[model samples]
Target: MSSRKFSIVSGFFLQDDQVHATPATIGALPPRFGLVDDSPECWSKFKSRIAELNDNASSGTTYKVFFLGRHGQGWHNVAEAKYGTRAWDDYYSKLYGDSEMTWGPDPLLTALGVQQAETARTAWLKEIPNGMPTPQRCFASPLHRALSTWQITFASDESFPQVMRKVMILENLREEHGVHTCDMRDSRSLIERNFPPPTYGFELGFTEEDAVWQADVRETKDHIKGRAQSVLDRIFDDTEETYISITAHGGIINGILAAVGRPSYSLPTGGVLPLVIRGDDV
Candidate 1:
């Protein structure tokens, strides 16, 4: 990493009545000991020593993350069930009437879902002071449903500023249960026939068939964890005092929690999970 020096105003260092001692009289020091009289070589050596001192001065810095979950009631369960039933064809015909149902994007949240998000915002704001500094960075999934949930939950909150919000179209956080690009145009029968078992039976010698299915889920989860890690790495590497808020799906949030070694943590709809990451702790 390249090293650079920048001046920063340190409020903690300001001289005030709170400080117990008087300022030291550097000008009263012996003339031979003055900082200006030091040679270039000596000054360079002194700077290096100060850098080392600073590094050893204290414990590592800590970063805090807050995760916001989207609302409940997705269409996937109903859609998948319809696909498995004989009523599938008739259901679609009746449901769409003259129009055709589109499968490309996920369905929007229900009215109850919107209420859930609003409830969460109201609950959260009740605890945190409105004047408290908001998170320095906010990230949200690109999907309309997730993005909508984020907007409705935080946009109305007095604590969250619109300028801090940013959307990240992370493919890694996309649902892993659906058909991929390769099977997009395939017939329903063909896709259904290729669907793998829900659970892996390890006693089966890790067969190629089993491997493929396991790889699909594992790779998706791994990618989600990697993306979460990348977000954290960027924030910490910059050494900025940024509190982070990430709005994503349940699966992706689960993956992040698992990556952080909290696999038991489950975030409910519109729930916020706060995490503190410390350099020394990590």
Candidate 2:
């Protein structure tokens, strides 16, 4: 495996066992901050702390803040919930869908999913003015649910910060490849038609057809982590954005957390995780 370029800087946030609780949210962070001594728990202070980390970073080292959001509930989630994980994984996940709903080749958000995205929108709208460092860059997985969540959570409302409205679609940001039909993305042409450019751009050299997925294969956890590492390498190498937002799947998010040396916390649908990461030369 290629050398890692980033590691999580803990103690600044409540990212330990506290985040592992059911229905946990980013707001669960402690009010008294350590990033800046005696600083109050507010967005402005958080932004200032990030700036300080960057300004003081040593040569060949850089610090960035990433807001990783998991896409809201999809039909696949519903199916899994209905069937239970073992059955879904062993039998149902490979199929196009159940009799009631379609989840194959990319499933869109369910009603609950849309509402979950709206909740995220409300949270961002409420926080941005409170000194939330607006994400300098935004990215999303190409799957329909993630794309839709990105749109609804950032661009649907005109009142949101303009910077949050646009996002680049990264294939590497997608869920673990193959086996499960829900993890299989649709054609690039269809994705473009649904999420057009200016608002949604593709990574350079992105193929028109789904390339990584295989109907008979399921990517192992280690492979997913490697893919996540490659995507992070791309981002850190190609851009200097200090604050970034990525909308993706639970598996992808897990891989990202792992790549950055964070604990294996299960982010719920529409859940957001913020990481203060320090990147350095290997």
Candidate 3:
């Protein structure tokens, strides 16, 4: 892979204290979707600004906008909530789930999760008319929850056709891998059965079964950040899409944000964060 680094570009988004202080929840588009200045055509202006940045960028450098979306409430989320973070991390996460639910080896979304995804879909529908650029490309974690979230949010509607909204599943985008059954993804064949190709595509070298996940070894945050950087570098090197979307887990998205030097902010289930970043070959 090419040696590349990324940095957050402020001034375009309302990532200022005021907006970041607010709770980022499902369907809660940051005040005017975090536009630095409010206007009827704010999104259009923002799009133009991105184009200008790329057009003026020196060779080996490019600017792109990323929409980082967290998957809706999975059974694991509910399990963690019920069990509390400490207990869940120590005990519950290792097992499949409690008696009431099963969240392991890629659990499906809970009902609330589905509702949250629908809310995300509605949010996108409301913004498109406001000049929000439909994502030129969409990427998702191999995990089922993230895949389902992407399907509901971007691919469910006829307004966004499949040709325009192709989703690529990336293994590196999966949540901090290992130990937690919730982090373990299902077999690729199973995933393909549900989210079949023509619309859903897997990254090159994707394996048939879970390859990186190991039940005994949990990945460190530093390792997750490194993985995030690797995937970002791959995307920057291979794709020309200016507007991109990634549906992934909280830890994975957090690593992505941190890798780009953005402030840390927790996204509620189904929540989305928009960031503008510049990548330079080192």
Candidate 4:
């Protein structure tokens, strides 16, 4: 980790009025103070401070040299609007068999989602073509909305689109699990068939069956934070990239920020935030 070349992939200060982060350049995210990831001394200091900052009854996402993205709008967004978050969380699947909820266990992006992703695609095109770094690697949650958004945001039709070949599906990157019907994913078998091998690679290390999804379980702040930490550790330890992109959900992004002691931020559907891991931080 110490020797890895660190850089950024997009993002702004937590207080920004807007969701999208500015393009990669010095002086981006004006209000953000102190390189969030500095060195080992700073990392220890940050952990102690985060341990204190995390005193609220409810707990926290942060990342470095990473592109954090939320899945675009989904059928679940519409359902939640009609039914509200509480009931939609509690009874949508049982009452409507998921058709009225997020369309199914693994929700797909809506037309609006595709439109939102296209908007994101426009941003990425400008950024990537204008000297911003393209991802050295890419990862997406197995959920349809996430995978779909990944496809739209990163896909290129040029003669050599090798980056597409490099994308991998990371089950750990999926959103908070099992609380809402829309969050429950499709069967692993179906997922594997849909995502396929190294060509459309699903990480081989992922398990065949979901380990979570208990009827009574809802991912707590601690749960999410731990998951965020675990995922970040895996990425930083294993990746060859100085830059990366994660197509996942708002909750996971939130968790990541909090866990890493960075200022908490929000990323709406198709929203993208860029972060850097200064070489000093591990």
Candidate 5:
């Protein structure tokens, strides 16, 4: 890998868990505040990706709308900005000494990051005032920056129908981990305390401690590919939610897009892009 690539591979936070669950195999999608149980028609609509059963069908009716978002800028982004890619690859450890102790763990969003989140909300208000693209089910990276972005994006929005408000924290959605100290998330207890119910809540059956995180390993992009495919597979298979949002990192967002055969998207901080997933995509 080039030095720049090395910087990303070694310094960027990534979550590399290989989720085996697919939509077909995942037993059930956890309940979301806004999702309805799947119907046979919904499955039928899901299977026919190339042909729209109804040409004029709204996004909420036929397409599995995904609003994939990147979290706002964090302190880590600032750190990366301080050095050239080559410098970072060579001197990241020596200059910083230790990642966690030197820079700290799970850095929160910077002021600009907060602004980015606000911008997303404002744009949504202007464009989709009725919450047409608002997510019924939301998933976010477990890291602090991502969680903070998820909070800020919806901070003032009363537009989300009651069901779209709940947020699920997914370890799989985390950025590449073990490479960056800023990627380290707080313990499950801290998450439950910080992002509580009403605004953000955990999936009922998901665990607080994750074995995948405990593994303490960094994953290659190819591995991320598998992870992305699994995430997409499970999301489409498990839920009947018409609209969904994922608050994640840039790399992971690319993974998701790549998994589904879409061109990679460049999402800015707090950026939200809607993607329609069909059953056949998996």
Candidate 6:
């Protein structure tokens, strides 16, 4: 086999476990990251061909993504009520009653919520073709609810290797013109003030509210979107065929999808959304 002996600009020598290169080496190296001189036909031709392959793959390759999930049920759901106006709190108290409004640090899934997660898992498993590349990466929000969902879905499956990453909280997923928070149990006026005109639900509405909860309650949509996008960018940058699985809050998923120009899709407690990121996008 014929081999070219051109120097790399900067690269890891796995045998030595160290990085190497100088300005001189960089100047003589192939243009772009992770390139090596294994072929000598015009570099431009190789690059162009690779670009074409990437576009074709992105458009045609069906990426398999499994969304492990966490229900939004948490203690904060009730604590936020106390901060609302007395009238609002009274209305909420009547609605939910004293059924232990908030969950503890590691809350158990509600009956209906558990069903949601299981349904999501079953649906994803059915969609993925057998013997496809196992999930290349798995990420989850730091919250227990989300973590638990991930554990339940992939903990026993050897196919998916899992890792946890901090992501923007859910409250930041709203449209710029929408409200930030609302008393899910009460206060029609507060709901109107905090949420968008087309509400999601009436029984436990205010899934999109941002009242006077806390200064830190609000995360800039732009910032959160950037962080989520960065996660995707890094994954795509690293490999030509990386399949990423992110187990995160609904909002974080929505933010990342939005950044990629997809319509906002809600991630149920254990829903999965598979995305194929083309190498060219990196």
| Best prediction by TM-score | 3
Query: Considering TM-score, which of the candidate structures 1 and 3 is the better prediction for this target?
Result: 3
| lDDT-sorted candidate list, best first | 3, 2, 4, 5, 1, 6
Stretches of candidate 5 off by over 4 Å are 1-62, 89-103, 204-210, 213-217
Query: What TM-score would every model get versus the actual structure?
Result: 0.51, 0.91, 0.94, 0.73, 0.70, 0.47
**Candidate 1 residue pairs in clash (backbone atoms < 3 Å):** none
| Candidate 2 Cα misplacement greater than 4 A, ranges | 1-3, 16-41
Q: Model 4, range 151-227, lDDT digits (tens) per residue?
A: 77666434224774357887778888765666777767887687665545776666667777655677887798887
TM-score of 5: 0.70
- Model 1 lDDT tens row, 60-161: 544343434544433432443546545543343123221222333345555655776676566546433422234565565544455556667666554555
lDDT of each: 0.42, 0.81, 0.85, 0.63, 0.60, 0.40
Q: Which 10-residue window in model 6 sums to the lowest lDDT? A: 8-17
- Give the residue spans of candidate 4 off by over 4 A: 1-64, 93-102, 159-161, 278-282
Q: Quote the positional error of residue 279 for candidate 4 in Å.
A: 7.6
On TM-score, who's better, 2 or 6?
A: 2
Q: Per TM-score, what order, best first?
A: 3, 2, 4, 5, 1, 6
Candidate 1 regions with alpha-carbon error over 4 angstroms: 1-61, 77-104, 130-133, 157-159, 162-220, 279-282
**Per-residue error at 188 for model 2, in Å?**
0.6
The candidate scoring highest on lDDT is 3
lDDT of 2 by residue, 1-282 (tens): 235477887655555333443334434222321122343456676677778888987877888888888899999999999999999999999998978998886888999999989888877776666556778889999999999999998889887667778999999999988899988888999999999988999988999999899989899988988888888887788888888999998898889877877657777887787778788878
List RMSD in Å for every model shown: 19.5, 3.1, 1.9, 9.8, 12.3, 18.9
Superposition TM-score, candidate 1 onto the true structure: 0.51
Q: Using alpha carbons, what is the TM-score of model 3?
A: 0.94
Q: What is the lDDT of residue 30 in candidate 1?
A: 17
lDDT of 5 by residue, 1-282 (tens): 001000011110011112321222221121121122244343233324323532554443334667777888887676666665566545552243335423436777888989988776665565443223456788888888888887776755776465666687777788765555565667788887888766766655666664453233566787776777667666665776666889899888888766665555555666665455544420
